[model samples]
Target: MDGSISTSISSSRSSPLRFSHNPPTPRPLLSPTPRLTPASAGRQPSARLRAISPSPSPSPTTPQQRQQEPMEAFGFDALKETFSVDVAAAEARPLNVPLAAPFTIASSRLEAVSNVAVRVELSSGAVGWGEAPVLPSVTAEDQPAALAAVARACELLVAARSAPLGAVLQDVADALPGHAFASARAGVEMAVIDAVANSIRIPLWRLFGGASNTVTTDITIPIVTPNEAAQLAAKYRGQGFQTLKLKVGKNLNSDIEVLKAIRLVHPDCSFILDANEGYTANQAIEVLDRLNEMGVTPVLFEQPVHRDDWEGLREVSIAAMEKYRVAVAADESCRGLLDAQKIIHGNLAHVINIKLAKLGVLGGLEVIDAARKAGIALMIGGMVETRIAMGFAGHLAAGLGCFSFIDLDTPLLLSEDPVYGGYEGILRENPAHLQFPFVNVLLYSYILQL
Candidate 1:
C-alpha cells in the first residue's frame, strides 16, 4: 500500500520467482514464516554466542612490561614529591621546668623526666613539632645523649638534601647500625612525619585513610598505696576518664587492695592491669583468678609474665581464656611483625599491643596489618611521650579501627609539657603558666632563631 511496498513489489515482479497476472490467487491472510539460512537452522545459540565479546585487549608496551614494580605499591614516590623535610630549618625548645618527682612504678621511683622539644621543617616553610621526654630506665638512655643523638641525626639527614623520611632512616640505621638509640630514632622519625604532614596541610589520621577521628584513651594511675590509688582514680574519673589502667606488679596483695579501693569509688570504669613483665606464669594466673573472684574483670591483662617466656605466655593465655574468660595481650614480647608472627603462630595471646616507640611508626603499621591479617585483635599503646608523639599514636589509633583499647596516657603522666594547650598536663598546676630560666640558652636561642 505504501510507495516503498509498491517499489518492492515492482522489483519482485521483475524477478523470476514473482507471480504475475493474479499474484498466484493472493495467498491466504496469514503471517509469513521467517526463512532460515542453512548455516543457522541446524544450530542453537550458545552461551558463548549470547555473551558480549569485548574488543581485543591492547597489548602492553615493552617498556611497561619491563618496569620493575614494588611488592606493595604505596604511591610512595607521590608522597615524597608531595612533602619533603627541610633539614636546615629544624628547631628545638626547652621545657618550662623539669618534670616533677616521685614518678613511681611498682618496682622503682623516677625523679625527673628531662623534656626536650623538637621541630622538623620542610623546604616549603612548613614545620612539624615533637616532644621527647627522656626515660633513661625505659629506653636505656639519658637526656643529653638522646638530645644530641637526635640533633646529630637531624643534621645528617638535612645535609643530604632532605631525603624521604624512610630513606633517611635507613641511611642513618645503616650508618650507625649498633649505635642507634630507640628513643632518639623515634623522636626524629615522628618529627619528620609531622613536618611533612603539616607541609601538605592534611590531618595525620586522614593520611592513614579515615580510620578514626577521636578515640577513647585509658588513663594510667601509677602504682601507689591503696588510699592514694583510690584518690587518683577518683580524680581521673571526675575529669571524664572512663577507662583506668592500674600499674600492678610489686606485691599481689597491695595491687589487689588498690584495685579494690578504686572499685569502691568507680565500679563502672573498665580496667586494664599492666604488670610490665613482673610476674611468673603461675603468679599471673593466681592474681588473675583472684581478681576475677573479686568481681573486677579486666578487659585485658598486659605482659603478665616476662618477655621471653613463650611457654609461660602460652600457658597463661590458655588458662586465662578457660578459667576466667579473660583475654591476654602481649606488649614487650612483640618487637616487629616477625615477633607478632611468632606469637600468633604459637597462639601466645589473644591480642597484641603495638607501641610505636618499640616498633618505628612505619614498622608498627606493618605489624598492625600483619596482626589483623592473622586474626588477632589489636591495641595501640604508647610509651611516656610528649603531645607530639601522642599525636602520631593518635593518628595510628584512628587509622586502625579494630583496636579495642588505646593506652595514650603519656600526657597525663608528664609533670611538665612545654607545648602546653594541646594536651592536658598531669600536675595540678599547669606547666604552661610557669616560666623557667635558661637551662640551655644556646640550644634555645638556636631553635628560636630558626
Candidate 2:
C-alpha cells in the first residue's frame, strides 16, 4: 500500500494442469553466463562496488560493477520512463523449465524445476512478468497447486478494492490466508510488483528507497564427495566468488571431510554449512565442536537440526554461539512473520534466511523489517529461480543494504538464462526480444500448452 508504486490484479483460474515427479532432461553446461553486451546493455550508469581487487573482496558486486563493462557504454537507461499503466489483466504462466544440470540437495535430486510464472498486461499495453519457482522441498507446494493458487489469487484481485500498486499486491497476497499456497500466492504478488515497478520508469530498488544498489551472494555446493567438493570450491573461487555454501547432513563425518577439502583448497573463502535439517541436535553440536578443534568456523551454521525440532534448533544454536562463537541461522524453521517472531522472541536463531518463494517482495520486506527491529541478521535468498525472483531479492538486498547474508546464486547452476532483465547486472535486458540470448534459456514454452 506504499504510495511509491501502483497497480491492480486478479482473474479466473486456469484449467487442467499436470504435475510430474519426473525431472526434466538436464541440459549441458555450455552457454556462457548472460552479461550486458555493448549493443544490448542499456544506456544508464550502473552501481559500483566499494573496493574490489584480484584478491578475495569481502563485499559482493555493486550496482555499477554489475555489467561486464558499464551500462553507459551501451547507453541503456533501465529507468527511462516507458509508460504509465493501469492494471488490466493478470494470468498464470506455468512451465517445467529444465535445469542445465542435475542438482542434488539433501532432500532430493532435481533435473529441472517447475517454474510457475505470472504475466501482467497493463492498460498502457506494457506486459510485466513475475515468477515464483515451485519446489516442495522449500515451500511444500508443487507446480499444479502453485499454478492453481495463482489462478485463484488472481480471481480475488479482480474484485478487490483498487489502490496503489504495493497495496494491491498486498491485497493479492492477503487473499491467500494461512498461506494455503504460499509460493503460488507469492507468484501473483511478484507479478504485480514487477509490473508496477517497471511501469513507474525506475528500478524496483528505487521504489524501495534505493538504499544500497549492489549485492554479493554465496553459491551453493550440494552434498558431494570430499574431492568433488574441493574441486568445485576451486572452480567457484576461480570464478571470483568469495563465499561458499556447502550442503551437509548426509553423513556428519563426510560433511566435515567436505568442509576440510574446500578449506584445504580455498582457505580465505567464507563458508555457510547448511544441514537442511539433516542432523540431530547432538550431531549438530558434535560437528561444531569438531570444526572448532579444526580452528576454522563457518560464517554461519544453518538449520542444523530438524525443521520442527525447536528445542534442538535452539540448543545447537545456543551451543554453537556459546562454545564456538559461531552464528546459527534458521531456514526451514522460519517461513513467514510468525515463524520470524518465534525465532526472534524465543531466541531460536541468530539469523533468518528470507527466500522470496516463502515471502514475496512485500512479505519478504515485512520479515526483513521485523528482523531489523529485533536486531536479528537477514540473508536474502531464493530457490533455483531464474532472474525474476532473484532479481527482486537482489534489489531489496542491495537497496536496504541490511542483509548480512545472500544466497541468490542458484542461477549460476542453471545452463540457461530464462529471463532478460530484472536484477541490475545479474540479469540484463537482452535487446533480442524474440528469444533469450540462449535459445529456450528464458523461454517457458510449456506455458502455452495451458
Candidate 3:
C-alpha cells in the first residue's frame, strides 16, 4: 500500500461505486446508502491498527532526529472538488424523550436533538457520507448558532479558502463571544475529522491509530421502573450486548428494584450506573450502600451529582469507597483533560467517561492520555448520532485500548441516518456501503471547486 500522503484532492479511480437513497425518491432525505462493488473491495486492514503499532517508537531523541523520522502520510489526492449537489433541507427532529425522573440532572427539562450531515464524493463519481449529532440539552442556545456558523465555515473550507482545523477552531472561538457553544463546536470538529478520514480512504478508527477493528461496547437501557429495566436488560443480552449501563437516581428504592430485576435476568453481564448528575451526596451514599447490601456491585457510578457539585462528588466517592467498596466515575464533571486532572488530583473519582462530542476530537485524545497517566479507568461514549458519527466513536474506542467500557449505541438507536456504507451500513439487510472511490470523488470535487 502507498504510504505517501496525497495533499491534492483530485485523482484517478480504478472502479465505480453506486449509492441511492433507501426508500426511493420521496423519502430520500433519510440517509443515503452506498453500494460497493467487487472492483472497489480492497482487503486492507484499517489505518488505526497501523498507527498503534508503528515499527519504531519515538524515543527521547534530539529534535533533529524526531523531525527526520518519516511521518505517516495521509493520501488525499482522490478527494478534490467532489461535493456539488446541494443538500436538501430537512425538518429538524425533536429529541425530547423524558428519562423516568428523579434521573434528570443539569437541567429541569430536556428538549431538541440536532444533527449535521456532510457528504463526500470520490474519484469514481461515487459518494460517501458522514454525520454528527448535536444535543440541545447540553449546548443550550449555542446549538443552532454553532450549526449555522459551521455550515458557513464548511462552505469556505471545501473551497480551500478556510484555515487549518486548529486555526478554524480559533476563528470560530473568536467569532463566538462565549464558552456556551463548546457542544456545537464539538459537532463541527467531529465532522471535519470524519471528512478527513473518509477523503483518505480509511476508517475513522484507523485515522486515530487504533490497534483493533472490533471493540466491546456497553448497551445502555434507560432508567425505568424495575420490571421495565430488567426486561430491557434481557433484550440487550439476547442481542449479544454483554455489558449494560443502567440510568439511576429516580429514587433509591426504585433504582435498587431495577438493579435487582436486571441482576436476576442477566446474572453474568457487567453493570454500570449513570446518575446523570442526579444524586445528592447523602442520597448517592445511601444508594451505594443499599446496592452493596444486595451484592449488586457496579463497575462504576457516573456523575452521581450536579456538574458543579465537586464537593458533593468528593463526599460521595469517599463514602462509596470506605463503606460500599464502589468506585465513582466522573462524566459531566470531567468534561475534558483539565477537569479529569482536577478530579485525579483531588482523588475525586476512580474513573471518567470520555465522550468525543463533549470534548472534540483532539481534546478527547488529550483526556484519554491524561486519564491513562492518572491511573483512572476510561469509558468511550457518544450521543445519539448516525452510523457516520458512531463510526468515529468506534475508531476512538478501539484506539484508546484503556477504556474499560464503550457506549456507542447511537447509530443503533437512530431510526434513520443521512449517509451509508460503513460498519453498521454493511450489517443492515439493505447494504449501503460507501466505497473508497466515491469518497475520493467528492473530496476531489470539493477541493477543486468543481
Top TM-score hit: 2
Candidate 1: stretches off by over 4 Å? 1-86, 91-101, 172-180, 420-450
| Tens-place lDDT digits, model 2, residues 341-407 | 9888888888788887876656677787888887777766777786666666666565466766667
lDDT tens digits, residues 218-241, model 3?
Answer: 666666677877886776655545
- Best candidate, lDDT-wise? 2
lDDT over C-alpha atoms for residue 118 of model 1: 69
For model 1, which pairs clash? Answer: 212-398
What's the C-alpha lDDT at position 250 in model 3? 63
Model 2 misplaced regions, further than 4 Å:
1-85, 158-162, 424-450
Name the TM-score of candidate 3.
0.68
Sequence-dependent TM-score of model 2: 0.76
Instruction: Score residue 410 of candidate 2 by CA lDDT.
Output: 69
RMSD per model, one decimal = 26.6, 11.9, 11.1
How many pairs collide in each candidate, listed in order? 1, 20, 34
Q: Estimate the TM-score of every prediction.
A: 0.73, 0.76, 0.68
Candidate 1 lDDT trough over 10 residues, lowest sum: 34-43
lDDT, model 1, position 227: 94
Question: What digit string (tens of lDDT, one per residue) describes model 1 on residues 107-213?
Answer: 45665546556677667766666655455544544677767776776677667775665676566555323313655666666676666655554545445643333
